[model samples]
Target: MSLIPLARLLPRRRSLGRSAAALAIAAVFTALFTAPAQAADGRISGLGGKCVDVAGASNANGTPVQLYDCNGSNAQRWSLPGDGTVRALGKCLDIVDRGTADGSLVQLWDCAGTPNQQWVVSGANDIVNPQANKCLDVRDRSTANGTRLQIWTCSGQSNQKWSAPGSGGGDPQPGGFVVSESQFNQMFPGRNSFYTYSGLTAALSAYPGFANTGSDTVKKQEAAAFLANVSHETGGLVHVVEQNTANYPHYCDWSQPYGCPAGQAAYYGRGPIQLSWNFNYKAAGDALGIDLLGNPWQVEQNAAIAWKTGLWYWNTQNGPGTMTPHNAMVNQAGFGQTIRSINGSLECDGKNPAQVQSRVTKYQQFTQILGVAPGGNLYC
Candidate 1:
């Protein structure tokens, strides 16, 4: 958590320094009974977020697997590559003695690649064996540690649920946008067509480390903060390009060597963060491998590029503040710091409390929609 800083990582900008800050601070999935190979390894958590562990860190065949605290031990680590095998400590998860009926015990054993060793993820995080048509579940529906595993009728209960690895710990849709499209609609009911949801999602590929970091709470908060600022800047995702025509020519800086190749007025406020200025366009362009200097209008025309430009600033630029907005939220520096990072020179420290409060209000409302308590430092 100490590395809390940055806006863009893996186009997700998560402060994991990689997570979804950049939740979009998002990272990690695949699907079907086993999900994706990308989702197979690490730890399979079940029953109160505990990891599936090899008992006593054993490697011998027939060792039992149980729910234990996530200790990152080799015993707790597992890989399910959708090859029909769940492996750990050089062994496969198997049913005792190849028993097929209910109450068949489960344990770690040498790889057989048989039906007894194969498992699948199905129905809302359930780990099942298609051969058994039964779920890999907790024995006796117990939440206690060291509880054994067994096959049981699928009742769609919590204990029967299993979170595959690479699921962002507990998030169901890993690497997917953290904000539901419905929630997004709710947040920006009047959003401009230029600022499409698909655009933002597409843009996430650039900052792969953005939201793929930290605990679940930090990930969501970073995502919310980023969206809120974008909302405020774009006027509820309304305007695609800056409105003031008079300010257009002023964005170009004559002193820079590159000297506004796109024309003096091309580098104007545009996109989600309302990216402006020739130097800014050059910086973000250089970072993104796009030629904003020659085509500043691309920010207004391309939705993904526009969103990417905004993310590039968020995950990188400190603006007038000391830390990037991504870092502020990841570090629990309070929403106030994000404002400082974004436009604190103009809005914080009593410069424009109204503007600051406007952003804060949107942040509060957005966090409410996301169902997370807005952490402290709500204002600058």
Candidate 2:
């Protein structure tokens, strides 16, 4: 890949000369690498760990648990019980019907080593069901906690949290977090939460002008970082549509000169980047030359639009010219001084600094997998 190549994937502006230093930083970020142990295990950690509840699951001696959340209870305190059972508070984490669908639910059952019943913990802290060689997963890490756990194709990421028994300082609840299925789609298949490998393959086949560019290697690191950040924002692409759209309710109802409509009016923020508000719609639309309000859902339904919105936020809102996205992360604000910025509140909340920083630490795990240096910038 050329250090400075053809037209950038997204538009760039000159007024943002302030971003030049940051871009320089991002460009040089390509030298970083992943942890050797984690690489060997195929696990990555950075997304807030998923909380599971062991409620109703059996844990007598060897029974496994159906993964759930910790409502500040002991049932959720799971550890690896003797044999294959996941011993928590006092229960084990068992597989349901021994079935492993890249995205099916995980249930607690008797202590049995049926193929689906066995599981693996990777260096990246990802829990994998030995039966399918896939990681445990959640639908989308939906804001609503206590979501069900399932088995899905694996992609080492922060959302998939695990802990080794011998490792000192391990969380009392081992293997509690699982990856979001949508995240898996974005990584191996979608080319890092932004472009789909399938889509790229089809585009290459259909468009003679489309070049593999072999740029995948160059962008691999950046793509990983971008996906991590997005995972943090969208909770694993559970709501792809809302994850990429703009916030609604243009103005605070009481503050608006004209009262805003009720109900549907508040459903503005949608998609991965959560595009919201008439102003944001106009801004994104004008930037991409699309009429967003006319079709609010376009941002999520169209991959091109989705990519554009995310990239636009990266350029316009986060860090323009900062190709690597490292500096832009700081914009996440108190979330962490390290996070350059965030496109939506769905994840960062733009308030909790500790949570934001922790997420950045998780994003670093993915970036490391792709050879992106911590605190370093990346470029063509």
Candidate 3:
């Protein structure tokens, strides 16, 4: 949901008769009370566009509520259930002592439906506690994780403005097939701590093919297929760089003009799909405008870039197969075609059924989690 600045929403009054004033006031009240509520799921974007999160993804009462880099975990999902309470992990967001004072710490506690836990969304996007008449404030206006949350007099400052279901967060649904941070985490719980939700969101926003190329079902399946291959490629994204160090120098293709600008050894496989080969890096860099050809380490250093590289391969390259993974999915070519597109020479032709099965299993699990049916042609 978008936030409107309070200053812009203020009413400008001109000289008017009492009857006219009363009619205007009534109209304002009607508009205020009748505004539609935004959906309850998604990120709660706050200061610095960071998300309000449950520290450590904990469900325990008293867990600190703080702003953190959005990682798309269950810890960041929030709901403003109509009972006037804001909730996460099925717990109420509460103040330390129902304190009306500024700087009172906010924490998660069992929902008691008290006035202290009740909050209302104001026109300026401040989450206001009716009892205290104060807004949920980010202490010290810090953007760092673990920064304390507090209650302060409504100021309409950026620190106090918030957008719900979070800005740039949520599931790939009917319109766009972008994966929600929650869905990504579910598919790869063991993903490297660096593979964050914000990063993946940025990656998807950067590349249109993954989510924009197909039908909603195809979009979901495409995401599943890509991540499944990514899982197999990097062992559930556990390894940031290729495990076999010997392959490092081998990735530099001397045939390319801008060959291995980061150094011959720098083009080794890195990121979710284990991007390798100097030519691949050059192409991905050209498409992403990030100069991966000159500094492939950017993939390892930046999570969003890493994911972008994976999507680049999935959408553009066919390798030994006849079609790109993007086309294979959008055209209903089956999951086996995607595996072949990614690594047909190594895993297809009955050369490695076990490896093929590994990819298929991950895809199946992901499709089930996404509540989609995995289509046919399970094997290459």
Which candidate leads in TM-score? 3
Per lDDT, what order, best first? 1, 3, 2
Whole-model lDDT values for every prediction: 0.71, 0.42, 0.71
Runs of candidate 2 exceeding 4 Å displacement = 1-221, 241-267, 318-338, 343-351, 376-380
lDDT of 3 by residue, 214-300 (tens): 566777888888888877777776777776676577777676766677887987778877777777777777777667888788788
lDDT of 1: 0.71
Q: State the lDDT of candidate 2 residue by residue for 306-359, as single tens digits.
A: 545665554455431332243334332222321344522222335445545555
Choose 1 or 3, whichever is better by lDDT: 1
lDDT per residue (tens digit) for residues 1-380 in model 1: 12111221112111111122322211111121222122334878777667788899999888888877777789888776557677788889999988766789899899987878876553246666645545788888676889888876454445666767642222222446667667877898666656655456546656755655677677778888999988777678877777667777877778888788889888778888888877788888888877788888878876667888888988888877888888888889988988888877677899888888888999889888988888998888
Q: Specify the poorest-scoring 10-residue window by lDDT in model 1.
A: 8-17
RMSD of 1: 15.8
Candidate 3 TM-score, true structure as reference: 0.58
Error of 1 at 137 (Å): 41
Clashes of each: 51, 62, 2
Lowest-sum lDDT 10-residue window in model 3? 1-10
